[model samples]
Target chain A: MNRDALSAGLVLLLMAVQVTFVNRLPLPGDAAPDLVLLAVVGYALARGARAGAVMGFTAGLFGDLLPPAAHEMGQYALVLCLVGFVAGRWAESRPEAGLAVALGCAALGPVVAVVVGVVFGGAEAGVVALTGGLLPVMLYNVLAAPPMVWAATRVVRGRDRSRVRSRERGARRAGRLAGGRP
Target chain B: MKDTRQARATVGLLLASALVLMTVDHRSGENSPLGPLRGAGTAVFGAVEQAGASVARPVVRFFEAVAAAPEAQRRIEELRGENERLRYALAAQALDHRRSAELHRLLGTAGLGGYEVVPAQVIARRNVPGFEEAVELDVGSADGVRPEMTVLNGDGLVGRVVQVGPSTSTAALISAPASSVGARLEGSGEIGVVRGAGENGRLLHFRLLDSATPITRGQRIVSFGSQRGVPYVAGVPIGVVERVEATPGELTRIAYARPYADLTALNVVGVVVRPPARNPRDAVLPPAGQNGAGR
Candidate 1:
């Protein structure tokens, strides 16, 4: 339960970093990688679909309602909720799901965002927007997906590992206390 | 693990809630019921973003050095010192020199345009997966920045203020897919509309209202100014025409031009509180030959 909160907090902080640091990078094509989306994909891959969906919704609301956000209040919320679900489910089934899922979701995020933007927000889905804008962000996200996803999952999974270790140590201590034998 | 009904239900619920929120916000227009929530969010995240902006500055400088290496190489040569000790300091000094030069040119542009302005640094910028480009300025309502005020940089028109917080404001660049600016040909005074081509502000789409205006390559363009100049002031240099499209049967002639301001990498900007009494005209365009106006 506490692990969920830690993962969500990390993703929220990543959103802050996204708006502040990532977006300002002097990357070619003037498009920065979608660190927030990758963080969500990162969290979802470790946590299951249910937790992923909840965390995705929470982070999506944060992204949508954040200041400097000009789009309709739930555009990202809807897109990311679905994205979280897809990534979680994909990871759940394929035991070896790592780089492939991470990269797929990274690429999928921009396409879905463009679709959601065009349908609800009336955003440009034109050829220029695709070739110039979507391409770079997609490329950047794809390149960064593996390491970012690994980092995010490590934040969630690292705690679980430590908690299990502590529990095992507690069991050994209890056994020794009971009889001073093993 | 198999697909569980519980996970499916949770996803459904979140998706529904999101759609409901989008619908409510969309139907309400400018004065949405979520206004207060948005304000609170701005209060919180805006602060975080501000802190992040300071951290991003040095990193940006490093990248700018790499991106503009060819140009910086020439600058390094011009900045070379007689001794090796000072050579190590050249990079930092060059970066600082560039920043100060940007500020100097920003004020020079404002002075030439006769605009009363409040100077501000770009604190943060948000792009819509590359669709729209918006930047957060450190100045806000406290600095007399209201929605619709013209914004510019050292080069030329940057954008216009859209939303103002207590200590920060958001401005959408002239290159946003949704943005459109009224423009006039510098020499012929032919009227046209400048629309963002959505190519990351690398270029803009301009359509001359009069098909017979005889606009050729290398012609300059300036803002036509709105009534009272709410969003844009008159005679602010916009860009120079780079390519004129071949439109035989169209009512309006179309052309493409590069924006004057480097909308892709913004740093220092100014919000105009008051516009010039009279149009500054071509005087605002860099005094020939200097701006590479291609005579």
Candidate 2:
């Protein structure tokens, strides 16, 4: 399969992981890591803003559309889209900005999400929720970032190679069609 | 420079679309356009989850047992102490068994009544992002499961089926903020309403209908069977009163009931397919029937 399909499949697989195991694990503080968010941040950081934003939108839409998604639809989508953009633009200078960048994105993503959820969806928001739910979740996301970032970077690298190969193949086809010497 | 412009446009477009979808979803009611998509996701994912749970159950149990060892040890010790006290009680209980058995035989006709139950396994669980609780079950409309059916574990009432797919159903647990059930004080037969207090708290809040009714802690609570028994079936255990809080300046008092069924640890449960038989004998507290008085 092509890079886009593979990446999408993998992201969906990560979502399944979030639902099946991550949510169920007896983690302290009832904070489950947002696996999909971590994946989005890593993929976006590796691929640049446009790819990241698109991936974020798609992944967030699926997150909203999927079952067990209790909140109002598109809330996560909006949160992640903005998060993807923020991560992409901030880390633009160096797409593969490593662990610190990934961790920062992990921390910021949920904060942005919680803010947007409260502001737009009128969700419950208070100091307790922030300290109790958001912070711990961010920490959990940070714990999950290393492997997630590594896998995301690999997906991005594979896509880069595929794009390059396809471009070269098109160029060769055009050259042959133009009588070889033009 | 050019990449920046493209990135800006992409983010703006996607973010705008997301906002639009969110607004539409919020405004739409049961007919929300995303309902089918959500159901499709649930049906597919529920199957995969159930399969995965079966495969992972052993692994999960190993870890659970490892984590639970200390607690288990403490509980064993506690049970040992309780056992010794219960030994004397058991001897006294044996003397009453004949009378109790006769009572049970009579109550058996009146107790549990005509409710036909269907057993189901919990396939998946998702706390609706901290505000609500829901679970996907292996049985659905196909298994005679329907919306509003009362669900229970062996211990007590769990919740009610809120949505049904072809092969999977979603149950809105009693823990959900919007959920409320008619409950009865087992000893006095006094009725009250048990309402969920939201995710911030674990216990359910109940208020008595009459302020004059005296309530005490540790009183057993059971379902005050509803008409036609859609949301809850009568005679199903709900909880035990943990504490009674008198509302300041108000005549009524509130009691916190700890549910008998461990909602967090639900694995297998039963759904009542039919309501219990309504009879004249049901009106009699400690229902009197042909065999003897009910327990």
Candidate 3:
């Protein structure tokens, strides 16, 4: 019930939805909105640099596995890590961090994704493919981010406080157990 | 503080790994180690996906059932009529079977020819939008499939196998931009090279053997088979001529043909094993008539 476990479960849930359901939505050329990126960005904004970086890597790894054509493994992980780091840093600077972080990350997410895709996927990448396939996808993800963030906020705000308390109790119990062992 | 540095180092390592993967992929043209890792990732993701689908299936089924109610009723009525028609067709087929048996008996044929048909289910689709003209089929080298073999559905030609792997083969549909087939007009006997024009149809560029003989619209075109080295079989129905035009006093006529098979609705297809011999020399025209043509 700890934050890390909850985040991990959410990440898997989002990735599964992304691959099986969201991708099947009658989007242009089978393009799906990047739900994993949104989750990473949201977590980064809520937490800080270290958390963002870790979550981003996990999400990117999941994204890399979603497509058969995504033969390049760590490319997504790298790009998403950078995305989370930047967003996390930006979130620290802003007063109304949640919405601003979500919007900003949404805007920048697609550019990073396309650049990484082209660099790894090869030279056969066409303008039409980028514009039609990747661009619309980015736009869709950006549009989808706010609602998902709001929903996550509701779930996290309700469950996270209790989860954090339970984790603290467990940590204290572990500390006592370790102290008594020797 | 050290943890922050470790996190940065991890990110750096990931980036470096990505770059190395890209380099390896570019140089080798092979699926990198990343691909298998990604596949494993997908498998995990796929499980969650399946779980989500299982949760949502009843809702989807309800909606589908509601939507299909009227259509289902109409379909039942239509099926009743179709059953009557099919019964008549079946009777006719029985009569034709008797005649066919009599002819075969006169020819001293005892049994039906031995032919094996294997059914393959499409597992993955990899149609690169606007660039490549092929999709990968799950059946591959494991299924006795090889490159350059002709693929056909119940209607007509689908495409040819281009890349084969242990478990998968990429079949380039005829509608792809890179696809080229040699075809000859069924009526006029004009030979031409049919190339996919990156559209729903193909562009037939005819080689004018004699400038005097002009091709008209609505002419039937069939595969001209292989030339000296080009790979394709003869007598495969390519398409019918939709439009033809003389290129403003040019020697040859340019025509567009719609492929006989519906390229998009492809599900099951048969791969023709033997190559058909319908070379340019095999065209009914004499060598004198074939001279000066460049197809």
Candidate 4:
């Protein structure tokens, strides 16, 4: 499969796992980790801004369509897409995609989610709820990011090597030249 | 520079799409075109959830049991000493059985009514960034679970079913900020409304209708039973009064209650599918064939 298809398939599977099993897992309180967001942020950081944004939108759309979704349809979609775009853009500009950038994006996820919620008529999206859920979910994403990013990068690179031989060689040469420059 | 332009374009397009989707969904409400899509997703995911539950539960239990073994052993030792003291008090407390019986008669089954329940296991929880407290049940419309049905656990009331899909349903916990229920204080027979405090797994706030009515600490509270029992049923325990305090300028006193049902650790629960047994009209009307007896 191509990178696009592989990413899409992986994201779909992550969302399914999120709603089916991950959400039911026991946590410190009643809080459940946002596994979908974790996957989105990881993929975005490994890929670039455009890929991240697209992945975020697709994953968020799947999340919105999942059962027991009480919020507005596109609220999560908007928040996650922006998060992915921002994270990807940051990674693209930097020499390397740092863990701090991924963590920062995860932290921003809750603020964006709350803003979308309040704007979409969920007036009760106050400071308390934001703070209460943000820290834990952010921590969860950070903890899950390393493995997810590694897996996503491997899949994308594997697919790229098998399909676009010439583009793969060019990108590899560019990567080496950039590495050698500094 | 090219990368920057591409990033900006992608972000702008996706954001615009998201906003449009949200606008359409908000305006359409339940009639949103995505309803069918959501239903289909629920059906497929619900089955996946059932399969996952069967495999995951045993693994979770095994880990929890292993982790809790040491603590359980320590607790047992403490309980053994406490048990000896309790046994001594048990003899003395035997004389209070008559008073306990009287309280039981007044309270009626300690908040359990004569209604059967449908059992359901929690499949997923949709905290949704903690904006709402809701859980999805494995059973739904097919299983006779309907919106407004009362949900409870072994200890007390949990919440009510809010929305039902074909094979999965969502329940709003009583801890949600938007939820409120009529409550009755045990022993005092005083009525009040229990309001959600918005803190998940935290104490619920209750205010009596008549503030002057004396309510004390440790009093049990139960559902007052709504008309037709749509939201809550009578005789379902709510919680115990953790504390009572006077609001200096307000007439109504506020009490914080610790719910009996462990909302955070919920697994299996029972939904009250049938309504309460009595008819409201019976109170105002005479028995069958007795209307003309006085005349």
Grade the docking of candidate 3: incorrect
lDDT of 3 by residue, A93-149 (tens): 563556877887876886776565445543233333455444555677778889876
Docking class of 2: acceptable
> Which residue pairs of candidate 3 clash?
none
On a 0 to 100 scale, what is the lDDT of residue B31 in model 1?
A: 91
TM-score of candidate 4 on Cα atoms, chains taken together: 0.75
lDDT of each candidate versus the true structure: 0.79, 0.71, 0.58, 0.72
Off by over 4 Å in 2: A93-98, A109-135, A161-182, B23-28, B71-115, B127-133, B154-157, B174-261, B277-295
Off by over 4 Å in 4: A29-32, A95-97, A121-133, A161-182, B1-6, B74-113, B177-199, B203-225, B240-257, B280-295
TM-score of chain B of 2: 0.70
In the range B1-295, model 3's lDDT, one tens digit per residue, is 6756765776676667656755765565545544455445434433444456556546545654675687899899999999999999999999899899889899873433211234443333333323334444556666887667767665555677755555555567775544567667776777776665433222323333445666766676666665432345455666767776556766666676777765644556766554323334554432321211211
lDDT of 1 by residue, A70-140 (tens): 67788888888888888888877774756798999999998888788777765545566777778888899
Candidate 4 lDDT tens digits, A37-155: 76777777667788889889988887776666656677778878988888777776772545777767766776677566556634354344555555676667667767766566566
Once fitted onto the true fold, the runs of candidate 3 whose alpha carbons sit more than 4 angstroms away are A1-6, A26-31, A95-97, A123-127, A134-139, A151-182, B1-10, B25-84, B97-295
Rank candidates, TM-score, best first. Answer: 1, 4, 2, 3
Query: How many clashes (backbone atoms < 3 Å, residues ≥3 apart in a chain or on different chains) does model 2 have?
Result: 0
Write out the backbone clash pairs for model 1.
none
RMSD of each: 7.6, 7.8, 9.6, 8.4
DockQ for candidate 1: 0.50
